[model samples]
Target: MRVPRSAAVWMACCMALALAGCGADKVEASGTTDENGACVLTIGTLGPLAGPAADFGLSMKGTADLAAAEVNQQGGLRVGERTCHVRVSAYDTGYTSAGAANGAGEFIGQGIRFVIGPMGATEVTGMKPLAGRNDMLLVANGFGRDALQPQYPLVFHVAPGPSVWAAPIIAEARKHFSFNKVTIVATSDQSGSDIADVNEIRFTQAGLPVSRESYQRGTQDFAPIVSRILGHDPDLVDLASTPAADAGTMVKQLRQAGYTGTFCRLGGESTAEIARVAGGNDVLGNFFYYSMVDLSDPRMQHLSAEYEQIAGRPATSLTLGWLPAARALLRAISAAGTTTDTQAVAARLRQDPLEDPDLGRGVWTGQQEFGVDQEMSFPFYMGYIRDGQPQPLVRLEATQP
Candidate 1:
């Protein structure tokens, strides 16, 4: 027998309450009706707006703003019998733990109920308490596995978690090139280490031998790390979830070292920025990343044009997922018929999968990994870069293994 979506959501919530020891009543959404009787919903964007990761924060904020504008232009979202408009408030967290706390504080102060991002491990953990306290629904694009529990049930992850991405990335590697052995170069931080560890396990599971190396986060000179990675003389070099600048620098140094092997960045975003930093496409040789989207689709083309018109530049992979996240939140709110009940929105999200325009079909299910069911699983796009130009190849469906 087919189970009802509401029944599934109710069971998930009950399990969360029992396991997370978190009170659903602690935080409350504070949406208000304007004098015009239209529901006014405020959403927040928390990320690095001032530091080295500012580009990522700005792109997230810009894409979110565009999504809101598009919704408002369409006469607003339907919330029960009324129409609702969205207001996006962005905070510059400097990509630090303290900044994340401060941004969360600001959101709480303004009674913001929905948030887009605050990428990275440290920042997401820092914002968890505030998110829980404020009863806000946070849709983050970072590594949220460690922070996800019944305690922070409001927090949702849009990116692939743990074992999910490994199979597809490995399969793509073998298909794109004849790569059997791999070497990993990741930042020596909690986030990078977690990703690298997962990659190691997944590669091993896929019957591929892997070697791993790490460098400090701010190391601009990647020669030392690149030298160590190349020492393995592996057929593939995995830049495991490195930031844009660092990954680009590593790519440049690897090319200069005459390492003509395949280059793969598991968390691929901001390809144009990486290409520019790597001193052009010639240096970015035989690159493979897992974050490409079909921009040629009319819906995507329209979104991209709108984003470029608003952001004052072209949209890259980094900006692609924000719209889907925003749309999903709206979808949840409409389904729940109320924005004040954050859990209701989350419940609706878990039960009903959305046809995401950018990320393809997506569903929320993480019962096996995280104790809670909040991770959004989707078929991510894979791309191939030859000489410098990236071409979107096909959708890679994640596997259970």
Candidate 2:
């Protein structure tokens, strides 16, 4: 995460929060920016802001912002005996590795010790060196397998990886979508391939035939790929890709191709912008996807309401994942009891695992769901789009069996 000179005011403000210790080690935390010597804790997000995948970044930004506000209003986080208000800092990486690295650098330059994203797995991978250099604790909001490897110690992924969805989606395929054949469309990126490349094996094992094709992550034209897939005439279509401008565009082309069949999209990223670009609920029907939906889980209801109030936007996957990440990190801070030590916080996150307040009786550790031991904290759900809404398809459960 190399720092660039042109960092925006949003980046600068977050840096300032980190420098000021985020009311964690303040002389006296008055809970206002003007308060003298108040500690300020900066949580940074490294996702695209205004490029192809800007919608995901925007969703991340909104949820992160909501988390910050909720933490502040709850009278701040309790670190040992002191309380420090949480503040979120956002940086737009523009969906490129270099851009993500630059944002990470800027946050590190300004003393930001904690980050919420670099959400895309590739972006997170690129920022590893920088986060290591600055000793930052990163909570990634994207695919997990890429970040959950043994070596990447600074980051914790709250989202379930591909394996979680592969089996479940396959099961759904058996139940609802009968097939002798299927066509798959995925982005031509490492993470996408990691998830998409397995369609043949998984599909055949489930007693269904499958064919696949992939395009570059930012490629919008799906005409050729659609033609080829439709030529084979798949019983159902699998979109094993992330939500970006390309994803929405690809769906439109498929719809126009007169391929009105079952469409199931794994994982999640949603926004008003995407809905608008898709133009009138065209891509809504038969869209199956996975996302965080603990709304009725008692544990998440409070935070969900708090987010809806603060951001003035409907609560979705972004808010659901972001709030938990905030609480998880805050718990780490409380356990470690220091604002300046990134490594110490990382250790706390790894070793101290926090219990989910959303599920009143169960305790979860940071390592459990991610790599640790908490099942009650991190759970995955399945859903399908019907009448333009993603209704929950499975109860929230841990990533692995």
Candidate 3:
């Protein structure tokens, strides 16, 4: 019999709780040792795998799996005298606080020492306490103002937040499209409000008048929100933190309402999906957005080729964003020489240079913004779409906070 999604999640959580009770003694420094004396390590991935933001979560899972596979294929990670074979366990959080909390519990019950996601702001907030208390290392992706606070030493950011990149992107967009006034649309939850708050500050500081509009999550018909947004008579509309699917629907509705304005998404990368959802590239005329990775780079191309070889399909730009952090986690574990002691792993991660063969080099930033230098800041792309055709992406260097 086919089980309902919610039922399946509930059953999984229950099983995890039972396991926590039964396996308390079995939990050790890391994974089990094989007959060949190889350490088998399991890393947990927490994210939404069955919701509007599933695209981002699935990308996170894919990249983490790829990182693990790469390590295993290279004869596993060498930690002192032992070899470690990495494995990945993924749990879908459904992009909710309760889901994230439950997913964290599942990981804890399974004795997972490291985790790779819980990308949304709410998901990060929900999972942080449990992960901190259990001494789990997290390479998280979230845009909340407190996503990388000093209190959470084990938590590290996968990418810099809008506070670091938004101003530069806004300046670049102004060069191509003139816009004096902006309307920002996002969801009504913390994830939306947090990112929208940052974007508003950045836009206002750039001397542009800004207005805000929001809708309840899971609202399929965006006609009312579109009407409200159009009432502001904006020259530019910024989809601050809307999921790609929701942003696509909003783009379609706004277009149908006869609003001819430039569009910008200063949040996550989902341009292709957004364009597809908005009908076609032509419908997304004069659009600007952020790309997590610059695909034009030959190194990035090689990374894509490697992913296609391993995953049997092309990797999305979003998936590429998670690669560096996932790979870094394994390297840190090797450097620390212990998978169980996350504190040591975090230390090694901070000391090591944030460099990747395919993605290039990054810096450990966020000290100025979050009072901790745990966020990874990589060079990203500011992409433009004009008259429904994509323009050559403008590569931007990573900026310091």
- Per-model TM-score versus the true fold: 0.85, 0.79, 0.91
lDDT of 1 by residue, 158-249 (tens): 55554576667677667767888899887777667777877788889889898989998677567788889888998788877777778778
> CA lDDT, every prediction?
0.71, 0.61, 0.82
Q: Could you report the Cα RMSD, in angstroms, for every candidate shown?
A: 7.3, 8.2, 9.2
How well does model 2 score by local distance difference test?
Answer: 0.61
Model 1, 358: alpha-carbon shift in Å? 5.8
Instruction: Give candidate 1's whole-model lDDT.
Output: 0.71
C-alpha positional error of residue 137 in candidate 2 after TM-score superposition, expressed in Å: 1.1
Q: List candidate 2 segments past 4 Å from native.
A: 1-35, 198-205, 269-283, 294-305, 352-354, 359-377, 386-392
Q: Residue-wise lDDT of candidate 2 within 1-401, one digit each (tens)?
A: 32222112223333344444542433222222326655567677778878766767766777667656655654555554456767877898877668779998899787787887776657876787788777887777556345554456776765545545566666864554455677777767755665665555566677777777777766646678778878878767777655546666666677777877766665454533344655545564566665555456544565566566666766666566555566556656655667667666776666533334342222343352246532224555566565566555565455443
A best-first ranking of the candidates according to their lDDT comes to 3, 1, 2
Q: In terms of lDDT, which candidate is strongest?
A: 3
Off by over 4 Å in 3: 1-30, 34-37
Candidate 2 lands at a TM-score of: 0.79
Instruction: TM-score for candidate 3, please give it.
Output: 0.91
